[model samples]
Target: MAVYQLDDELWFPDPHLGEEDGLVAVGGDLSVNRLLLAYSNGFFPWFSFRHWKEPHWYCPLDRYVIFPKEIHISHSMRQLMRQNKYIVTFNQCFEGVIRGCSSVDDRNQEYGAWLGSDMIKAYTELHRLGYAASVEVWEPQDMSSGKRSAKLVGGLYGVAVRNAFFGESMFSLVPNASKLALIYLAKTLDGMGGLFIDCQFETPHLKSMGGKHISYDKYMGILNGEKDVELG
Candidate 1:
């Protein structure tokens, strides 16, 4: 046993420092090295500075995951899919998507924008390095009129690691934009083998995509199996 244990406490200092599950440490600095290492080991920092004495690390016993092929599209969504009214593209506007996702002005979900300025800089840097990616949904306008045409509707941004994808966040300017993006993402990622999507926590939106919990060991294996991200 380690000298200090954060048992029953839902935070850990580093991935290696994590307990069997739930939490691992506290008060550790949130440096890039530590964050990256934590992710690589299936641990993530999810603390409330307002509530907790210090930052906490968590690696839940059951991880939420969605298989690409397992994505669920409703009949109404199918109609929208057939329309193809919106053009969906990858990595076209990553920062925009991140900002959209960072918005906390939605019902049911509380208004808490924790992505922070630091997060933007950090992920944007990853985007520059080609390790992170974004998907954009644009409403196409009639080109015959020669207008700039349409506005950005929705998008999702995440990090790709090997055959796995670590979903950061997503948002929609209009309803269903994010959902459409997820459908496209699932279809696109299906071609790759060993593809597993990590949705840090559970929600109704993710449940529709067949998100379920897995043993931490299983989650680690999937993350470890990924060697490099496939950019399209």
Candidate 2:
């Protein structure tokens, strides 16, 4: 399959035309409108920020997603939740969460790091416009004044289009912090009638947390309100 080159026009090729590896196009500005349109159609930009001058868009035919009701909570996570060692909040710290995802563990130093200054700026704008959100996990820290303040430890951020959430990136500062964020997000979405979380690709961790593969057509069906996702 030929890789399409994008220009100033706001458009994308048929997602089915994407290459086997899921890469469909390799040039486009990450304007808010472009990002919205891309995600609404199951396309997302992911490229090495330092290595590429333009965005690389991908839409995998095999979509990996997690229905809100199917998010798995392991025994360890359950125990941790009972302990109440951390605090979770939604959209309370968008910049902190994205910066943590971008820079945690020296991710920005890695060669294929996708979250950089431009992506951060763009997504921050998206958050301001209410199309993006963040789930923050904070650890309480005791201050010298005999008060306790929360420090940002871990969280995840993603874009939401109606009932579907397109996950972008997540970071963990302590063990199971990101998992807690995800579990919290899943439960919160479930309460609000969210259908699915578009994981974009499969990972063992995500699989363990109830992510599953469905055809792109089926994924789009739920996204477009044309069909309901079957929950197990």
Highest lDDT, which number?
2
Residue-by-residue lDDT tens digits, candidate 1, 1-232: 1314444333344344446656656556455555565666666655443355544667666788887878889998999989888899999888888877766466214423456565677678767777678889999776897777777789898777556777878888888998999888888888766377778788999998678777666677666663453211
Clashing pairs in 1: 11-24, 11-25, 11-57, 12-24, 12-25, 12-57, 13-25
Off by over 4 Å in 2: 106-111, 228-232
Model 2 over residues 74-184: C-alpha lDDT tens digits? 999999999999999999999999988987655566646778888999999999999999999999998888987999999999999968899998999899999999999
Candidate 1 has what TM-score? 0.79
Each candidate structure's count of clashing pairs: 7, 0
Model 1: residues >4 Å from true position, as ranges? 1-23, 26-32, 47-56, 106-111, 141-145, 226-232
What's the distance in Å from true for residue 165, model 1?
Answer: 0.7
